[model samples]
Target: MATIAPSPPAALIDGFGRRISYLRLSVTDRCDLRCRYCMGEAMTFLPRSAVLTLEEMAAIADAFVARGVRRIRLTGGEPLVRRGIGELAARIGRHLATGALDELTLTTNATRLAEHAPALAAAGVRRINVSLDSLDPERFRAITRTGDLGQVLAGIAAARAVGMAVKINMVALKGVNEDEVGAMLRWCVAEGHDLTFIETMPLGVVDEDRTDRYLPLDGVRRDLIERFGLVADAHRTGGPARYLRVPGTATRVGFITPLTENFCDGCNRVRLTASGRLYMCLGHDDRVDLRAAWREGGRDALDAAIDEALALKPRAHGFRIEERDAAPAVARHMSATGG
Candidate 1:
């Protein structure tokens, strides 16, 4: 039997006394589909040589688990699209068997979930988050530029067949898919899957104006209350989505409002890039390069780099959408940081 390594004495606690328990480690920045909101139509992906090896990624996950990270989520431009992703997930999922990690989950576009669901389930992943902005086929194609709604729907079905709990993440866009929020909620309820609406964030330079598509969740919630009679739900899923449930229904609907409210007080997560750069806050540009540290002096050096990063963790990410032509707070795209 392979022996599990003992965690270090001190835990990863930020300057604001917020314990870092969750880590979103990105495997690859390369993705198949180019969503209009996420990136430009013509794009250049990071060179393969710039990305960290699967062995390095697994080792970093182990290091985080040792430093009190309870939840490890493998995020990406699309995690399932990466080669040998199942092996990487299984390597980190071993911590679940030892009780060192509480959850080993992932967020995917679901276009590739059909081929990976069985391997992921076998790797000890019980839950997954799927990014599905629209239920309509034509709208989906337009939004994603190269995605097939039928393929995504089939992937979702494949995930459900493996007894995996699925949550559909929909980005509520004004003049885009706002009219379908009500119908989307109904579909989620009928399909026995939870649905979450996320306000579009200003991440990178896209073809369209961010203001044009920014849809506030406050209006969406008011609509829900009137239509479905939503009851406030205290369902905490470790992420920043405040939940609500329709009266007498099992489905829990979530709203992630980053624009209308301050959702950073309870922030306990950090994003790690595929290149091993640890970003303490998504909206801020502060980061620590762990690849060089790990390659230099191994785990001890990597842990020290993590400690240095905790000191730089901001109290709150001051995310504000500037003027129509102004630059975003953080210049890098969401895909580069890990969606």
Candidate 2:
């Protein structure tokens, strides 16, 4: 019989006294597709040598689990694109069996889920959030820049066929996909998948102006209520989304309004970049270099570094898109910070 280690005491309380229980761990800064809002077309990705090894990433995940982190979400420019991802997932997912981690989820573009869905399911991932901006083939191709819509749609279907719960994450862009959000909602209802609309955040310098692409989710929800008669649903998925269920259907729509409305008061999550840096806030650049800490001593170094990072976690991210051609909140792109 195997022996499970006892869970360690919680040590991730922020200055505001909020307990951090969620971690968005990025396995790679590379992606198969380059979405306009996320990164540039000619992106200069991180060298393979710069990223943390699979073993190191697993160790980091274990450290967080021991420190009262109940949920771990694998994020990325697209995590499925990472090499040996199946092995990495299974390693960290062992926490679920030990009861230290309550849930292990993934956020993906679904472009590679077709080939990796079964492997992910075997690794204890029951749910995934897919980034699907538009239902139209041409529009999707336009949004992703180089993505084939057929491939992604097939991937989503494959994931669902394997009993994986799917949640669609759509970033509301002012003239780009804003008009299609309603249509996407109706399609999500028919497909039996949850939909979430996110405001286009100013994270990095992209092709287009941030102010021009920004679309508030409040207006989107008001429009949704008018057309579909949406009602508030108390469904908590452990992220920063406020949900609303469509009447007479099993589908629930979510809104992630990072700019128009801040969710900092109850922010219970932090991001781990592929390079082993721990970011305390999504909209801020304050981070601790866990790579150096890990190299010096192991989990003890990581725990100490985490304490230093947590103590420095800001009360609120100073995000703003006040005007056109304005610089982003942080110079590092969302891809660098783990989408």
Mind giving the per-residue lDDT tens digits that candidate 1 earns over 1-339? 999997555898999999999999999887888998888998778899989999999999998998899998989899988999999999999999999999999999999999999999999999999999999999999999999999999999999999999999999988989999999999999999999999888887888888888888898999898999999999998889999998887899999988888799999999999998999998899999999999998988998999999999998887777577667778788889996
Q: After superposing candidate 1, which stretches have Cα over 4 Å from the reference?
A: 1-7
In the order shown, the candidates' Cα RMSDs to the true structure are: 2.8, 2.7
* Local distance difference test scores for all models: 0.91, 0.91
Q: Candidate 2's error at 221, in angstroms? A: 0.6
What TM-score would every model get versus the actual structure? 0.97, 0.97
Off by over 4 Å in 2: 1-10
